[model samples]
Each structure stands twice: as structure tokens, then as C-alpha cells.
Target: MDNVQKSMNLMGLAQRSGNLISGEAIVLNAVRSRQAKIVILASDASENTKKQFLNKCEHYSIPVRVDFDRNEISNAIGKIRTVAAITDGGFARSLQKLQ
Candidate 1:
């Protein structure tokens, strides 16, 4: 599989391993509390959502990735979500490397 596919698969693993947090409210809380090692924002997210997350991530000095669209991300996690946070540093770095 290509790197993108691998990344999506890895996201599934992360979720199953309880290392990923999804949904806007939960992710926002995770980012605010510095519990998130990295944040992934769906590329097709609304402009306001993109701006809010990008700015919040920038403020917190947390890494952010804008790669997969909402469908791809939701498919990987088995939920209809546009945002998610990786709490494990190792998984965060792995996702970053895949990009």
C-alpha cells in the first residue's frame, strides 16, 4: 500500500489502541490541555474549523497534519469525524514520518 494508505491504517491502529481522540469537542479539549501529541485535521473541513484548529495548534506548539479528507479519516476510525488527536508520541512521530 502507498504511504497514505499506511497512514490511514496506522490511524486505525492508534484508535483501537486508545491512543487517538476523535470529535471536535474532545479534540479541542485535548489540544487545550496539551494532552495531544499531534492533531490531524481533515482536508475538507470547513474554513472556520480549519482556522480554529490551525490557530489553536499553533498556539499550543503542537504538530498538525492536513492530509486525508473527512471520509477517509472517518473510515479509518470507524466514526464520522473530521478531527482527531494522537496522544502517543511514538504514534504521532510515525504519522509525521508517513507524511
Candidate 2:
């Protein structure tokens, strides 16, 4: 599989391993509290969402990735979500390496 596919698969693993947080509110909280190692924003997300997350991530000095669409992210995590946070540093590092 390609790196994108591998990344998606790793997201699923992260979720299963309880190292990921999904949904807007939870992710926002995680980011603000510095609990999120990295945030992934769906490419198809709304402008407001992109702006908000980009601003928050920028202010907090957290890494963000917008490589996947909503469908890809939702499919990987088995949930309909536009945003997600990898809370574990190890998982975040692995995903970054894949990117």
C-alpha cells in the first residue's frame, strides 16, 4: 500500500490503542490543554474549522496535518469525524514519519 494508506491504517491502530481522540469539541480541548501531540484536519473541512484549528495549533505550537479528506479520516477511525488528535507522542511521531 501507499504511504497514505499506511497512514490511514496507522490511524486506525492509534484509535484502537486508545491513543487518539476524535470529534471537534474533544480535539479542541485536547489541543488547548496541550494533550494532543498532533492534530489532523480533514482537507474537506469547512473554512471556519480550518481557520480555527490552524490558529489554535499555531498558537500552541502543535503540529497539524491536512493530508486526508473527511471520508478518509472517518473511514480510518470508523467514525464520521472531521478532526482528530493523536494524543500519544509515539503515534504522532510515527504518523509524521509517514507524512
TM-score of each: 0.98, 0.98
Q: Scored by CA lDDT, what does every candidate get?
A: 0.97, 0.97
TM-score of predicted model 2?
A: 0.98
Model 1, span 1-99: residue lDDT tens: 999999999999999999999999999999999999999999999999999999999999999999899999999999999999999999999999999
Angstrom error at residue 92, model 1: 0.4
**How many clashing residue pairs appear in each of the predictions shown?**
0, 0
**How many clashes does the backbone of model 1 have?**
0
Off by over 4 Å in 2: none
The number of the candidate with the highest lDDT is 2
| Per-residue lDDT of model 2, residues 1-99, tens digit only | 999999999999999999999999999999999999999999999999999999999999999999999999999999999999999999999999999
Score candidate 1 by TM-score against the native. Answer: 0.98
On TM-score, the leading prediction is 2
